[model samples]
Target: MTDSYRRQIDKLHDDVRRGRLSRRDFMIRSAAIVGAGALPVLPFGARAEEPASGGFMKLGLHNASQNDSLDPGTWSTSWTGASFNGGVFNNLVEILPDGSVAGDLAESWELDSGAKIWRFKLRPGVVFHNGKSLVAEDVRQSLLHHMKPDSTSGARAIVQQIETINADGPETVVITLTEGNADLAYLLSDYHLSIYPALDGGGIDMESGVGTGAFLLESFEPGIATRLKRNPNYHKNGKPYLDEVEFINIPDATARLNALLTGEVDFIQDLDIRNVSLVERSGDFAIVRTPSLRHFTFDMDTRVAPFDNPDVRLALKYALDRQDVIDKVFLGEGAIGNDNPVASIQKYHRDLPAREFSIAKAKDHLAKAGVDTLQIDLSVAENAFAGAIEAATLYQEHAAQAGININVVREAADGYWENVWRKKPFCAVDYFGRATVDWLFATSYVTGAPWNSGWSNAEFDALHKAARAETDEEKRGADYGKMQEILRDDGNVITVAFVSWRDAVSDRVGFGEVGGLMPLDNMRLCERWWLKS
Candidate 1:
């Protein structure tokens, strides 16, 4: 029986090497193998799960750029984060299926009775990629470096309430909070919390790649490809079996789809809706749909003319048909969204006024405001998403009917992030993450938030700050509810639609499981996947 199974596996790889087996053919053979073997090769059932093995996996990313820094505290772009995930990083906590935190770098952690202090017991014997032993002092130094306001780490904004982080012993770390923070666990689980080695030159840097993660950076070429090799000193047992991973940046969506279909890449993520059916219908490919926590919205400059008028903002909100946008643009792959930060997973998500689609109401507001021909500059990036350009075009057509003219200015990939997205008067951009209410509210909705949609209320700001300090679930929820109410009823922006991310994998890869919103380090388990024989 063993000999027969081995022969089948060998034959599969032989076909792959000879280029005689397309992904579709490989999948067909895989299905036969599954049925022919009465005793399963894997104890795990039919569901595709991550595989553990030694093989090279080629991954396709939307675009690659000069993101050399793998120090998670500072990296922000999705491509950079994905590159870090290959096995070179580990955070204190990891997200579980039920939305609770599980130990990753830290063996155990607990909050004080007052919720003002947190203690973490570190796992011993974990070694960095360079073979250095990981200790509690390394964790403290990395976190404290971010705590300094001058450090300017994005994580500083999220961990604002943390008063101090100290090494209690060689294997213990303690953190003091200026306020009772309930979402500390969530923040720790954030990818940005992935630890860095103890500093030597006044700070820690990953230029040489010295993390306790599963993969080590072997070579990198900005905007072209990044190559990573398995870490031999990895702490996790029986993990990181993949010999190598190469991420090739294919900016064009059509090109990316073509590459995946041609078996040039093993996995492709962020598949747009237009090509989803094409990939799905191809029998050789296995489509995995993960619930997306990412959402894109337009931010208005309320501090400037036109948008400064609450009536103008309210009228614009009524003009947008969220349902129509979702159906026509997203093609039934999205959910309706309001101008609120709280998503469905959030415990405090409250039902506010659903955006009513009424051109008449929009016209009335325009007339009351005495706007005849309204011209607004709308900025968007061509590289961000698949249908963003078309979505903006559709909105322009719809808004024109209501007597609003949008001067659409498209930006290039290289300049959009700095010159257009945030700096532009009216811009469409995506905010991706499973954020706690405080983090999301403070980042985009609060008075001085970097992405604040040109509207600010002192009361809202106070409540946002207090919510982080509350620590009590009920009270925190109430604070977030108030924040949501202010944004929904009186905010300056329109909530568009929540998008779903699609990943298409070839069936030759063996894994019976998929992923949820809570992204794992090896998001799709490339380490656990094996080429079918």
Candidate 2:
């Protein structure tokens, strides 16, 4: 890692050590910047594009896949991320707007002296959409199910440190970890922790959306649309006031924008950068732009040639113009990345100087690594992003000067993740963050990790495990910082940019708030948001 980059990580470590960047600060900034504008219970005042007579809100989603699993633990992509937030489930601890821990199903919690053991006391009289009361046993069962093998839920790695999770009583749940978890509170606040009721047969159903969340599932058609209705028996009174909510899947970005413009749908997930100003000028819609944990980059398979050598990988990093990609493609919608996996969510975030972009540098490395005529297969999902086509075009233009022949291969939108990305030579992908260092490390970089990009480092894995085992906040931060250094130096991954999360809403829509860090984490809140009548 560069000395400059190292200093930034050290500075972040110092901030954490000095207590300047507390969880509360992170949450409040996230809430105001991310969760603001869409007032939950407050009125939206008056707007030009008024809603129809009765309270009805229609949400249009663009470029999100269908989530078949209601179990939050199994969520993988943005598709599942959206569904998890759509009232299919609830978690014991809720992460409020300000990054502080809040009570959701569990009203109160206490940590043991060393912070290794945590106890949660649930609130009584909370009922699931199915009219079943949420009890302590349900939390235990839901968490245990996630830890079991064959559970693809994202929380398996994060919760693996827990030695036991059992109900202390009807309203109390206890969690005994093998050691101290610095971010235990944040982990529980994750969207994946949304709990489910105990299943009748054997295990939790993978296809059903059953939970103790605010809204009840009214109708669902995979890859099409999901409709939810207010849960009258919800624990929070006067909530979910809106009679009903509908989430429509419009995968085409242009089509989705059109739907929102024509008043066919009240909201859309992401907006094209070029259209932001256009939408703002219309005065019919409101744009919610917030910095997010989302990171996008390209991966080179170490198992493949050209990228097999570290020098070759580093050369490719120097060859492509990241700023140009962001400027021309993202249209200045994001911050430049330093080819590091750790994103803004980490307390260790640092601003690194841009890597010099030169075609000569790319040619030198390719020549040193081998003969000539470098051929690489570039795989991209058809519906991956708004500017994917444009970005690929630019990459082709710049990389051609380096004598690199990129065979641009596009995958079918339907089965791209299953059939192509996992086993591709070169591909572009993005990942959102988990609150804790261990959670992100375990899922993204650990040995045998599903997202490792076929690159393995023993020292990197060791540092991550050591960080997870350490209880002291300072020591844990130091350990994770070391892992980031290893990743930065090795050039195993290229973090293109920390893209801002974008959403567009009509002025007529009364309650459409977007969370900063993980907006998809709370989709059910839409049920309570209504159009200004």
Best by lDDT: 1
lDDT (0 to 1) per candidate: 0.69, 0.67
Q: List candidate 1 stretches off by more than 4 Å.
A: 1-50, 71-74, 367-370, 450-455, 518-533
Error of 1 at 189 (Å): 1.7
Q: What are the per-residue Cα lDDT tens digits for candidate 2 across 1-533?
A: 34544454445433422223433343454345334334222111112333242466777765445434455664555655555554556677765443356787888889984778999989888877777788887888877877787765567666777899888878899999988776687777666666777777535544566677667788877667778776778786666666677778787777888999998898887777778888979888977654456777777777777667877787677767878988888876666677766665556654355576788888887787775657777777645555665676677777888887777777666545545555787877666765556777777677666456667789988887777767676887778777777676564676777775677888777543334456543334463356676
What TM-score against the true fold does each predicted structure earn?
Answer: 0.85, 0.84
The TM-score of candidate 2 is 0.84
- The digit string of per-residue lDDT tens for model 1 on 1-533 reads 86786688657644432223432354567668867765244321134454557778888876455544665655555666666743567777766533456788899988885778999999889888777888888888777766665654557666666888888888999989887776777777666667888877556765777777778888778767878888877767877667888888887777888898888998877776788778768889866554445666777888888988777777777777777777888776666778765665455777677878777877888888888658898777656455677778777877787888877777776545445655777887766645467777766677756456568888889998887777577987888888888887678667676654466778876654333443322242544455554
Q: Point out the worst 10-residue segment of candidate 1 by lDDT.
A: 39-48
Residue 126, candidate 1: Cα error in Å is: 1.0
**Residue 473, model 1: Cα distance from true site in angstroms:** 4.0
